[model samples]
Target: MIRHAVLAATCAMALFAGAHDGLNRWTQDAVLPPLLHETSVEVRARGGELLRAFPVEDGRWRLATRIADVDPTYIEALLAYEDKRFFQHRGVDARALIRASWQALWNGRIVSGGSTLTMQVARLLENGRTGSWSGKLRQMQLALALEQRLSKEEILTLYLTHAPFGGNLEGVRAASYAYFGKGPKRLTPAQIALLVTLPQAPEARRPDRGARVAQAARDAALERLEEAGVFHSEATSAARRTAVSSSLKPFPATAFHTTERARLEQPEQAQILLTLDAGLQNRLESLAASHLNRLEPNVTIALMVADHTSGEILASVGSAAEIDDTARKAYIDMTRATRSPGSALKPLVYAMAFDLGLAHPETLIKDAPVRFGTYTPSNFDGQFRGEIKLREALQLSLNIPVVSLLERIGPERFMQRLERAGLQPQLQGSKAGLAVGLGGVGLSLHDLVTLYASFAQHGRAVTLSQYAPQPTSGQRVTASAAAWQVGEILSSAPLENAQLNHGIAFKTGTSYGYRDNWALGYDGRYVVGVWVGRADGTPMQQAFARSTAAPLLAQVFQYVAPQIAPLAPPPPETLIVSNAQLPQPLQRFETRDALKRADASRPDIVFPPSGARLAADPELPLILKLRGGTPPYAVFANGEIKALGLHSREASLGPMTQGFFELSVVDAEGRATRASIEIR
Candidate 1:
């Protein structure tokens, strides 16, 4: 009946106008508009998980879509109700058009839409008016041109992409996510009905504005689907009873700082891929927000986790995301902010010493107060142990011994080493000093994590990045042996929770003014660094690393990596031995200048320097010589004190012992000097 009416209308048009030529020009006269439109920018994580999204121009949520991206069931129901003979028609369905024409003329009002999916897509593309003869005719012409220019799938995709849902919500995927908090790939029966009917009168039937109207429209769509047999009657009844959502869900904005930065840097990219793990990033962001309440009002927290082997950043929290307090400075990205590192740099200094053969794990060094001109470095607690091994010094983060070693390593060389490894440490002025190893130099959390990752990577620093995995040069920061030993020592350091051992070799640090506190750790494969302080660099008394950043670091590891990863094994060249078993020169770290310090009278072994070979004959006695301290002294041989209360500076010892022995001379002041010798 509708086809016969269209032919009758054509015959009437022939009487008024021309016959064949006028009909041929009818569907091809209108101009076509641009089909391609702008879409929302998406920031994705590894494996294509969306971390964040930005609206298109004019603040519209127009996410790009395809036919496959939507639920197939919804498409079938839509085609069945919108245009039953949709596939057979070129663009305009004559049957639906003639029926709609008669209904409007009979009722004197608009009822069912006569526009096919292709015609609706043409109207959307051209932003043309409907409910008028001229507008309807233009849509028919453009729809014909669109059908000739694009495939059926392409026309459907255009409808799906441009269909409006509500305020700022365009496209089926955006509508599904906004209304239902999920994608359109697999929608529920009720959800499918809602999506199928929303584009008809988006603003009038918006669920957020009025749920009753939206539900009515959705139920009507379900009833239509039941009448057409597109869905079972029972299923359609259940879908009609399902209530419409009254609220819209906000889209995910995970990894806020990183994703925002990525979009700003590459605005043209529709999908920016980062190296973050979405699950872990979201977990840490929530953790960061929850953990901030325990600190001072001005304090903020930041942490970063990375796969050291691949140089991929797994999670990075710049600041507390949920805080509304302005004093916390939550907008700042603390992971990239520059601050003092404190004792966190001690391990690197020890690694340098071990690599240069200046010290060993068992090499003894003094922790006593030492002055360089007017400057002096002491332990953080202001108390010091007179003599301790290098391993214990690093484990305890003893500032004095680390400063002593830094003096030998040359602070300039230390900074150069860090720079070569792709870390840019900021110094206060032009020169580097021994204090640089303490808290003199500035470093960001990124710099700290990258440098610490070198220890986990066998002394090779891999470049840390948030982009897709890229090849790295793997700059050698130190010998593998040194890194291994440093990691081993940190693994044994005491933790606040005695039972909390995750096989992570971690270290904590506090700056001089208690301004910046840090905890950095690494396992066999991953590295983590945590920072806690005010973003303004203000001092927070009692905010020590052990109490502040270390706890957070441990919690982060527990949440991200529940399974413990063993620390790296010692390298082949790592020296593992007791103090007495170490080589002579390495037995004690006594620089030439150390002997001339505040106490010039400190004991010194002037003869049999160290690693000396002497005759073992019974008649030839080895004379022990000393240059400093009081004349009275005590000499220890092997495990026994062989001489006591000897007033002479020279004493005859070791005549009968034929094997190697550790000899020590203790001055009257109790200060001692040790030497290792071999007997032939």
Candidate 2:
């Protein structure tokens, strides 16, 4: 009789196994494939959301793109509370099932679930529990199928990825971040307990909806963990005493514009790792917000900070308010928008001048009124510092001196050098003019910051990168010696608030019509750029760079002071001298009339040697070298008096329009020599 009973039980087990296999086989083709390919969650950047393209048909339920690995402690607690024999069970725990069945039979109703973690994952994949007996059977078959198809880790990942955790929140990571404003990797014991209990009855146990219920559920999980010896009794007691968060916290929203741009550029990608530092980005956004609040309505501020050596944009705030009704077009990213860059380009001009041996730091340059044909450039204050050292003029941001230097360097050539160094300055017309030295040309804040970073990089122009480290090797923008000189001069400029002394070499610019105010600064390791203006291109009254942008620039530096080091020492060849100690040619950066009286002798053209072939690319400047010239001489290009300074034997006859032009030099003694050059 015992043998017959055993035979009957064995045959029943065999029939049950056959039924489960048939059910799994029938649903494998219809259900398993779709479950495997759920809509992925949005891409994230530096723990911040970058993009979300959830399918509308999915009821807007938040789904994870990928499951964040669970902390082992949480996993331990989870299994202790949910399924004590999860690892030993294939999909269902037979012992737990028997215990549950006995309790249900005794109570005359269901008391507890016998579903293992894999079975729970299967139920979640099918979108929550179905109370019907057939639904339970289906879940059991699917769980067994999942066990055969995936590894143990993959099964756990599916549970942690798809488990509902109250409202729109799903997954352990999302729940932790929503409740505690952090990821799940370093969760508190209470946080782990809360996460472990939420999925059982997510809506009823939502902390935000019913704090008492949530805490009770968490305490219950903790009690189970304590009973299982996974958590100590004292720790479980402490976790139960801790209060659960009753409100959800917002996730990080750093570098919003940058992340959006990355998403648009690579829409197919589900994640984008940017070089941005989240902490720094948050501080800058806060800084921008506070400053914007103090400014006029609709005035937006854009700022960027970069590592000079790596050329990584560590922080970027595209605008004060990315979306707002008061600020028209507030969504515009000002960092890349083309706007006039006023005197911000002057330092580069001075660096170029130093690179070309045109002037030194102590070289005296006139900041008086200077006329270039119909355009006469004057200092910002309309007052001249008649003859100031080039260093002092740059520190003072004197306009006329830079325009004069740009004239000597040739505006077109200056622009070409910039382009070669990875800048794209926008000129008003096809031709560049002297006005470019004073913000006459439009330049985005990004390009302006990149150009300024060259100074900190010892004259190398680093390409700005939003993601990953860029090549350290960069195009040489100027001589290291020249860059050092410029850096020293700028560093010496008086800070707007002199009490806060941070050794930063910085420059400011107010664009034409006050449409933009810009400040670019750098220390040893970092470069920061700031722009303040209205997004609608309307001028802000009295919004000068020194008053508006410099203070903000200085404040940004203060926030990052811990990361900055002193600038590198000047190159050995860099000249550090007083005004009186400069070379005769460097003593005064004079134009035609500023030099000493010329000698009574004829000056001969030594370059483009009378009949030389010259390319008239309009972009190339004709540098005329003279011989036998006096202390001061007059140079004429095509009958137009190009320049008056003759201290040096060379003069830059600005880019010639493609045509035959006569170049003549007249000495103070009235002796003249002429050369005819053709531009082909």
Candidate 3:
């Protein structure tokens, strides 16, 4: 019995030693998670780290560099302030832990954190941001292993890459440039100190507070430096004396929100460079702000501008308000909302007619109301102008003639024209009733600009791009004939306001009253589209005049005109005409019916004599074109039922079915000559 008891004691001692050795091995072999991971834990950890890294709100990262770009001084400052005696301690920091435990016990609360930078990294690695003791134990175990596996520099780099500085910013590199607008290397002593203090309190040191907070931060940092002996007396004094700037230049708050949120949540790390011009974006925002303040309170505006030649978005204002975290998560997206495009669809109708060989710029059509298949389209004023040239119809934006033109072109072909112009319709090849000519098609502003830009570029369809690194997604649209016709209509638009000095070609569309009010047009260089209406279904009772969206476009044109070339000359086939050339009959008569009636009453026939004398002069009219004037079925003395046909080659008075006839002779002077004929 005594020997058995001794054996049990020996085995228990061996088991404890093996367990301790196994723990040591684990401590020596651990490393942080891979820089990139597909698991949810890694994604959340990486997202949190990125939010701590860049100038972002959600997932959109705009940073161009990484942690290595930060200054060594900032690194040292962070190390000294956040974790003093960091190098001397093993992974656990037993003394610091004991001190923290005693303090917690004495206060009956956890007042101070004993976890080092390594522990924080480990916490993120194993259990993320959970607050349980089980998680803490795992974090502590992982921290010791990380310290044993990686050198101090590697650990520092990982911390620099993962630390959240505020907003959507991650790491010291992004935080350094984002907050200070300079890289880590350029951070002043005060700036470095501010960064070190940020890991402790990001909200209190937000850069938007401008110089005042910046100064307060600098003062605190200088004092800390004085305590640490890292700064000279002069350095500390200069740093304290420096003024902090509280105001940052205002940026377009909306697009930035989108970009920031995308950086935070998007799985694809492929960087996004926006096509928005910072300066123009600010100007557009200012315009909307001024206009909305004067208008009703609920009105919101969305503006998008594109380079007609390249389809690159020069400026885009998604909304007047900033898109914050809640908005991003809820997907209250301003960019994707569908809006009605008012009279903006007219040019496409005319373009289709030209392609089908049915019309020209000078084609005449009555602007009077006509019924077709139970649909009647009316002009904006609900009145009719008896007869108008096609040019006049379009220039005045008359609705009836346009509707008639669309009918001649057919609905399917018209939709094909729109598709050819780079418009991705939500529904294609629908029955396009008369309303289509009046901007009846529900399209987005993005689609409107694309179709308009095709005309502006003389029919070359440049693909549209909202982000930078332009997308080559736009298929080459616009058949050559359609392109030529649309180009003419845009160039000849009449300007009601003289303040609009640029050669602007545009279309103004209003859907009913104010459900959607659009002014979409282009100069030789840029295509600008403005959509104004309520977020909910409501009408814009205002007309499309100088006071509304027109002036906004006028402003854009006036500013951007010098950058592009003058309006190109209209296509050669396009003709300019007036009411004088387009004559209207006292009463409308069908050309086919008029000819049929004339054929029945006058049936006198004439024929060239069997061996008639041919005139040597090609300009001279043929003699005996006809002789005996008689009734229907009567023939000339030459034995023909009809007079010699116009060219002296065929007889017109042959049968009731043959119809009436006349002769035309070409004179040497290039003039036309006619001959009289008689039937026997």
Candidate 4:
């Protein structure tokens, strides 16, 4: 605040004499207060929205603010009202000082002090008393010294930081956020006047404590500026009519755990830029809080959404609201807590199977009872579909089929591929096994989200980031064809909501004993993962992913991205075919044990080993030759009996079609070999 008129003529003459003697020496050797102080650490969203902020060392809210970060209108009002010659004056305005001295002589009573903005910054920096002449003289000397040492902008910044606002709020930014519920970037004329007036009398003029006094003081400042033509008459009128907020708003705690973790990681960082959308993050956090009382005590709900292309985390809710709610175990960050993923990981197993050329989406898989050593997995419903295509098997989430496929792909290979998908699982077993296909491995929700995002990125993977966006890793988790095929199959998983026109590929899993419920999903660009469980890992026997976590996942997409884009087109190498049109070997699910059992006594196809293209006439019957098989052979074309019970070394089939055909010959022993050939 400016003080335009308070000075004693005798004190001024003494001050001039002292400045010529010891003051000159004192100004030259003046020690500036520590200019670089710890500001409140902030975690800001991509657009600089404050997601969260932590108090400074002394438990005061002193957030940093740059000159450009403030509104130019506010700066103009501030200069015209506080220091009319702020730019031209070096530090102390000699003309203002002389005017103050003459005014006190002419007036019968004391008036304002002739303290420049620089002098006020000096007193605030040192916390010096300003009523005494010595303190005033010291401030004047320090102000001149500061002007010599720093630029005019730097002096303004110091005042912006160190100026007092009521109740532990020490900076312009802190006051703005507390009083106005936002930053100081865009303040109205009334708000600017109040801010410019507060530093001089912070406590008495606090709006919350004394609204009438604060309003009168604000209006008085505006009236002065109006007389000086510092503001347009209309702006002055609007500002006077504006009411100050009588209460303060608490600083945002939108991404509470997110900002806490980042603050602890780098305590020295004053502000961290995160790749999150503030509006979306806030909505998801509220979503999590809404579920706190709906479930059992201590049950926490956590969710995360990330962009697959950039691997940037858009929103992360670590847990429900943690405010004194000890029963919910809200302090625990469940998103990073390792738990069994259950059937949520089955999609990766299926993708790996496709990547290894083991199966296609349309391929018929027998979801029958099976045992891998001592381990036997059953479906969630405890019933099996006699035989179904890979797509239906996955949509139905039959455990036997995926385990059977994983048995062929090998769990060790699946674990290795998981790493390529940007997840490093912490397994309970020393090595991955068939049981891992059913969530035997311990992985976090973040890990599951990253794995699903790999499918969205067409098989390439990138590490998810909260602090900033990470570059794509380009590491192939599966073949592009395999990724696309798996996505296409899961996208049809019957989880459609009326709110969505385009489908999202999602999978749900309930861990053994119902320890964890999970739903992982992805659309064209974003991947969302949700988890519902007790932080202490207590089993909720009735909890299921489909009913609990899956619904939450859908709700998240609805709140965050309801009209998500459709998935990308299938990869170029992707094979689109019906079950009957599939290559013979890929048409049937082959267990690794079945392949190991094959011997010389079994049949074999010697010609047209899959991937062979032929230039043959469509009208003519194609000669399908066989080399090794039983004496009496049954030949089939596209699962129909083209030739059966033929005691011959070769057979003729497929006389009509010009497209690809699956040729299989079953011997007397039931062992069959298949070949895929196309006629151009």
Candidate 5:
């Protein structure tokens, strides 16, 4: 009979080995692959640190894409509370299992679970459903299979990644953020004990919902840790005395728009890294919220801060609030909205003029009301400063002088320069006109910020980067000397009473009818752009750039001033001259007729000459130019006066139809010149 019993035990052992081998094969071939590739929700900031996280599905926040390396203290507490022999056992503790089985048999019910941490991880991976004895046996087999495939740390990572903490949270990191408003890397003893005990009965012991139950569970965990010598008796008592949090804290929501955009670009990626500074982003968001709360319900604000040298977008606030019922179109990202730029672009025009040697800082220019043919542009205050130095005109944002300079540079050429510099300004028509000098064209805040960043980088036009670091090599937009001159002049521009003296070279713009206000500033290391207006295009009464946008710009600069350096000195080629020491052409800006010769003859179409077959779609505008026309010529298309009193020798008859058309021009002396062109 004894021999028969020994033989039965040997056969049973053989059957158990065979079953274990089969389970290991099934886990390796069928289970581990999908479990290893589980999705994690992660967003990282500039330095590749966690910015925010969300759940993969059904509110299960599983940060399982990477191994979770938790704090040693939490790990010790977890082992002491969950399974004391976690490291020694392969997957299940034999002694504890036998003890639990005997107790269950004696009590006629299941008394306690003797599952190791690895067994718990296997159950979690299997959806944590052990409703029957057969299900529990299956979990035990899967746990043994996992032990053969993964290391102890790997198994622990799986547990930490999927352990239910409470409510919708399913990870230590998620639980820490929701309960403590922080990451799990650092936790108090009480917090660690609470997390250690949460996975067993997450809902029943949720601190936010049941503080007393959570505290009892946490104290039980602390008692286990003390008994196991992982924590001192006094320390465990103190931790047990700590009150559980009864309220859930909101997670970090800074850089919401930026994170959303990053996620969209890499939808399949579990971890996405962006070029954002969390501290700056938070401060700016707070600033925007505080300021916007005081403004009209329809008003909104968008701001961007970029590294001057690298063009990395540091802080990007798409709007004052991502969701606000009172704000019109609150979800719209205003930074990318195309709106009139107004005088914000004046610096680029002056920089171009200086690059072309058309004007100097000390050069005298008239700011009186000027007419480009019938189109008259007045100053913002409707009062002219008469004759002023070019620097003074730009600092004062005089409209007339800028218009005259734009006319001299040719609106087409000036716009081409801007386009070459990586700015896509939205023109009214297919062609550029003198009105573009005074924000007659539309450009997004992103384009404006990029253009100003070029000036800060000494004319090197680097494209702004939102997700990566930019290289130093970039397109040269203007002469270094020209950029230096513009930067120097703007650094001393007159500030409004509400503006702060941050020693920043800044420019302000107010779109037509106060529909948009912009302030763009730069130092040696950073460039910041701010826009304040109604998203629905409703005009605000007091939305001037100097008063509304500049102050905010200054406030942002102050927040980040400790991280920036002062502006550098001018380049060697920068010409610092007094009015009396200017060169001949630089002494005073010549008027249109002053630069013309007395013997200039009647005007004729120099371009699109008679019988010229122009392409149906030319990359450039359909330019119609005259050799010598008196000021204010009339351009007629098919005997219709398309444009009257054109001051410039050139007129752009936008894109023409694919048919034969007659283009006629009547000079100031009534001499009519005609040209015929065909579009193929």
Candidate 6:
């Protein structure tokens, strides 16, 4: 009777296997070689390449990766759960199946599984689960054939190399990283056991969804590990108590997220090095955080920094919101957001005038109110200086002179110059007015920086980039002389006064009423532009660019300047001064070499005897009379050579002015300096 019962059980198993084979065929095609084996070599190769490529769609790559290429703990964790007895089994585990069947029979329901890893692979190759007899036969046939065609190690490798875990994820290698963000080889024991439990019902046991059944299954796997004497009591308890991971952000899957999206999918590719330096990124983020924290609720800040010469983004802080696991999108991208630049546009307007040969940094212009037709340009302070050099006008951020300069350059031509300087003008055409110079046209901080980059690069206009593929050259915006002039203005005026303390050149810009404040400049090297305030059109009271943004920029420069080489000024010969005849004040002082003992109240103004040329190399000791409050001056020859300001005298200026004596006087305040020289 025992023999008969044993034979009966064996026959029943055989019949069951046959029925399962038929069911499999009913659902999926039960071809001879199986889908994978029958696949073309090209298809297999393509699959391997696709797996290797791991293309990023939208913002998300098909899988997560690290610089190391693989994490071993993830592998161990997956193996621990998915196929603990994988090595011990051949194509099938008959004893385990019998025990599972007995349990099902006793429970009156199908509550267990006995399929080995190899059998699972057979099922996958044969396609969807089918309970028909033909399906069972085909699965068994494929399993036996695979066993003969490949060694046990090969079979295990194939199974591990090609199992599905999540969306479009195939193979343990892909699934381990796709879901856990690590490689199978880098998985910890707990992580491995967790992954092992996922294959039974991936959706039902998804670690990210906080599924209770999945947790229970994971606990069961831990128990099995404990039974195998592989885990200590503390480890088992820890695994049982561990909570499921909740972070599972879907990487963006769109074409616009990368340069690859810009091109059609292809086979061959090249590695691209970006201008986005990781260290600079970290540094900028730290700076941006301080600004972001101070912003009002619902307000956001957008900022970007670029290498002016190479057009690389040294740092980019797109928005104030912290990046979370849920999403990588920002509501406000200052890099692209466009708004009226207000006084920030002044530099470009001035640069255009410089390009036209219409103005120089020393060009004297009235900062007083100007009326062109019905339009009257007002100063920021609601008042103006009667006469001020172009540099002082910019340093004080005076509005009238910029309008005058813009008018001199013609509004239409000014717009064209902006475009030439790499600014993308949104205006369909020109609108003639004074308001234009006061930040009339809408522009982004990104555009402003690009325009400034032209000035920074000695008048070369280059396409700005956040990512650098390779070094590229930019078109020349203006002659090298004009370019040097622009750089000189930017280095000294608004930027100089703000960042000179830290050895940087920077400009500050604020939209009307502080809606947006931007500071962009370069110190003979990197170009950094910052935009302050919220995305929504809420106004910040007087959010001055220099007050709000330049300080932070100065801080960044201070930190980075030590690592960079110091920037030297252009040769003195590059500076051209016109309407530059020696002033009578300097000529008067030239005749009084012996009047060194004059009183501070008022020194006698004497004229040099007409054509009475002093020796080409004069040894006259000119007295520099200084009041308790007034400053002394150094003289220059031909406005290009610095005459020694003999510092040994009680006054700061010495007899160095004797060689074609030209008096250059700087006030004690150090804010204003006056120069006077006689033409030889």
* lDDT (10s digit) by residue, model 5, range 117-230: 887888878875555545556666678778887898888887777788878787787788888888887788888888988898999999989999999988887877777888
Please name the candidate that would achieve the greatest lDDT relative to the true structure.
1
Residue-level lDDT tens digits of model 1 in 1-680 = 34433443343343245465665576566668999888899988996777888999899999888888889988898898777777888887766766775766666565666679998999999889854556666777788788877888899999889998888999998998899987798987789888889888999999999999999999888888888887898898788778887989988777777888888888789989999999899888888788778887778888899999899999988887453457887778889999999988888999999999899989999999888767787677799898999888888888889888988889899999889777888887999988998878989999999999998898987899899776888778999999998898898876664345657789999997889989999888789999999988889978888988887787787777767688767777677988887666688897547755623576767667677777788878888887777757898888688799988778888575678888888888888888878888
lDDT preference between candidates 4 and 6, better one:
4
Between candidates 2 and 4, the one scoring higher on lDDT is: 4
RMSD of each: 6.8, 9.4, 11.4, 5.5, 12.1, 12.8
Q: Tell me which of candidates 1 and 4 scores higher on lDDT.
A: 1
The better-scoring model by lDDT among 1 and 3 is 1
Candidate 1 ranges beyond 4 A from true positions? 1-31, 103-111, 233-241, 323-325, 496-500, 595-680
lDDT: worst 10-residue window of model 6: 38-47
TM-score of each: 0.84, 0.80, 0.63, 0.86, 0.82, 0.62
Whole-model Cα lDDT of every candidate shown, in order? 0.83, 0.77, 0.58, 0.82, 0.79, 0.57
Q: In candidate 3, what are the lDDT values of residues 472-561, reduced to their tens digit?
A: 445545545566556656656654542434467777777777676777778777888876666675655664533566667666655554
The Cα error of candidate 2 at residue 156, in Å, is 0.2
lDDT of 4: 0.82
Q: Report the backbone clash tally of model 5.
A: 1
**Candidate with the greatest TM-score versus the true structure:** 4
Error of 6 at 414 (Å): 2.4
Q: Give the per-residue Cα lDDT of candidate 4 at 566.
A: 83
**Structural RMSD, model 2:** 9.4
Show where candidate 5 strays beyond 4 Å. Answer: 1-33, 65-69, 105-112, 325-328, 494-502, 597-680
**In model 1, how large is the Cα lDDT of residue 606?**
61
Candidates ranked, most accurate by TM-score first: 4, 1, 5, 2, 3, 6
Candidate 6 C-alpha lDDT tens digits along 1-680? 23323332353387356676673453344244443331101101111222123333432223322323335444444445445566675565566566656666667665556566777778876564635545555665566566656786667655654455544555554556555654455665566676667667766677666557667877888887666665777888877777766566332211112223213332333333334554555566666766665655555556666777677655566664564312323444556778878777777766666666566666667666566668787887788788777777777788877877766567777677777777876653456455777887878777888887777777778677644433545676765666666666656653422333444556787888778888876776777777777666668865677767777766666555464333445645454654343232322111021233332323222333222244332454444333222334343334543433332223323344344444443333332233343333
lDDT of 2 by residue, 1-680 (tens): 23323332333244256676674665464345245545443545444533223322454334453434557788888888888787787775666666665666667666665668987888788764545445666676677778777887788877777788988776776677678887677777888888988998999999999999999988988877777888888888888779987888765555667766777777675556777777788788888888877787788899999988888888888887855545447678888899988889899899999999888988887776767779887776878767788888888888888888887889888888788678888877989888888887878999989998889999998899887777755788899999988888888777775345568999999987888999999999999999999878998888788988999998898776665578999888887777666544566785543332232245667677654458877677889887765648898887788988677888888787777888888877777888777777
